[model samples]
Target: MLMNTPKSLPVKVCKIESDARNTAVWVKHIQNDFEIIWILEGTGLHTINGEQYSLSQNAVYVALPGDYHELLINPGAQGYIVRFDTSRPDQVDSDYHTINESWLYYYFSKTPVLRLDAGKHDKMKNLIMLMEQESAAYSSLHSEINSKCLQLFQLYLRQHIELLSNPSCTYKMNSLLKQYFWLVEKDFKTQKNVEYYARELNVSANYLNHMIKRASGYPASYHIRQRLFQEARKKAQYAGFSMKEIAYYLNFTDISHFSKFFKSMCGISFSEYKREELKRAV
Candidate 1:
């Protein structure tokens, strides 16, 4: 059961479970805050942003504001859900603010879920259990402990990305890539050039491109273009803005440039893509 959290508190953590086999409740929930779901033991179907994924043990999902998610767990399934409002700068702790700049949060906007190995699973499980316990009791130190635990959780995820995600990636390369990705994410809209990001990362454009290409099988420019394309697709699919407005929203100089870029990246015109998506929806 989820705990009753005071509205004033910026962070809340609680345990979650599936109901009886015959009466399980699965409801679509909109993410209005930053949320993390850690499934300790569960076989379920998780629908996130209209895409369905199989939910298994040691699976973790991060949901940003505006994401649509729903979970249907089988009988006896258990998990933990943590919700924190980072929108309120003053209410959120400094540790959480640090996490906002972390690679885990940067990755969340792209890859929402990660499957943990046994050792990582146990470590996160213990941290989550401790958070649950702290959340259960109201104390003067409760908020501090919870904030510190959240920091540890972020550290673990960031460390996992560095140490486990790619075995061949060296520490220096991993650190550089993290900085590079973060920079691109921060400035992709206004600065779409790979040289700009390379400059910000303090590495030569060719070396940066080489390392990023080696790691992701795409050059640095590909990431920037992909990020812009992703935003364009999202706006086209969901927003009420027209192509011209979307072009302006993405800081494009003109509609024709936006259209050409869209066609090149998607292999279809913007209008054609939208029409196909509409037909599929219907």
Candidate 2:
């Protein structure tokens, strides 16, 4: 289950129009914040978490915190992109809070892409334009207005998400897995044990392992380790921190142990991984 915490919502909006002068080609990176990409025109390919998605006009894609995405836009592909930090707040409206929590725990956990109808697309586009204006105005109430706009945008997304969700699926199992993944997304950097997660979920370790394996085809520990490896690999490739510093930041006991773990899981040394990543960027 997702936690309810009050926090300020920080939102940033921008418009991208891909044409002769400005076409993005193979832009790939991991984001530290939540991102929503609303495609307005043309076609492209958007790959996230190693999954390729065909991007047509009106196709929306979301990248949650720690997700890696690549966008290669064809000429004339236009869209609005919104980035927001999902830091928990001290307080928020009960209804909005519930929706937000559900979104984090359920909707996004299911899929990163949502194709909107014309009406929904226009509504989202208008809201995003308003948010861009408010953000640029920098008035005394700019932050408040932007927050409200973002909440409205999220509500629209929630409605479509609910409509699109499959009712025939095993909801109980889905909920269990969503809760497990949510916990891993939040704590994987610091905690790496399946037992800890099982305890938090109020189930025995064996049962938790069984359920996760049954649902996802991987043991519960696999998800935890995958999350850790994702972060470690991203940091190793992109961040300026040294390997020792990266290991310490990720709560590893020492540099040697971290190196061994990385090689065992990833089949490459830290230096080799960085070298390959840099070459790919070029």
Candidate 3:
């Protein structure tokens, strides 16, 4: 019988190599962390967000924060389970941040499984092993070494995942819209208007807005505001930065303007939101 697991786990980076079926207990929990399960030798069932995936040798499964997942490992199944807290800024590299965002929006947003070929499987295995070794060594530089290894692992995994899952563009308009969304994610902080993005993509503003709305049910300006507001909310949570500093960071003309924008979009004053967040944390 499966048991309910805790809602959150302690923040850390750790790896375990196991062949034991008892590891299935991990699947019972929901964590506010990202996990990568590399199946070196296993045959079982993996489910994420109510979707079932066949677990087999050389397959990898990724779970994002708050995503419910389960693994039923059969007898004799073996694998490496790696987990790291997504909320820890000190442990995450900037490259990992970019890749994580891309994965969240592109791949993991839809599918959580990546089945790699033998060569790629072996390469990833080697990187995980190196990370495991460095983690166990506990040397003065162990954290740095492990972080670098994880960066390489993420880079390789993303490249192969893209190759495997690249969507066939049946319509050129779909491809163009995807490019426009990518640009919005990359430049939302400094550029918030549809005209700027349209000019950068070499299309007229009217056509660009039409295409984006047709594809995503939202206009291009909506995406820009959404991304900027997300960043603002994140920055607002940090106690170190004053509201004025956050407003400047997000390119708002003034603190009052930023506050008004935040309230309009988020339906709450910035101070009230932060206070609620603090209360929840306490």
Model 3 alpha-carbon drift over 4 Å, by segment: 1-23, 165-282
User: For each candidate, C-alpha RMSD in Å?
Assistant: 3.8, 6.5, 9.7
Which tens-of-lDDT digit does each residue in 1-282 have in candidate 3?
221122232223343334454544444444356777776775778766446787788877887655656767665666776666545556566555555544444455456887777777777878877766666556677666766777778777766765654343212234466567657656777887899989998999999988777655678788788777766765665556677888888787878988999999989998898887567446
* Candidate maximizing lDDT: 1
Q: Per-model C-alpha lDDT, please?
A: 0.73, 0.71, 0.66
Q: Model 3 reaches what TM-score against the true structure?
A: 0.56
What are the per-residue Cα lDDT tens digits for candidate 2 across 41-141? 77778877656788877778887676677877778777787876656443234434344444443455457788787778777788988888876666777
Q: Comparing 2 and 3 by lDDT, which wins? A: 2
Worst 10 residues of 3 by lDDT: 2-11
Model 1, 5-120: lDDT tens per residue? Answer: 55555678867766556424457666677788787775777776667777778878777665666766677778888777766667557446645543555567667887676777
- Relative to the unseen true structure, what is the C-alpha lDDT of residue 45 in candidate 2, on a scale of 0 to 100? 82
Candidates 1 and 2 compared: the better one by lDDT is 1
**lDDT, candidate 2, at 214:** 73
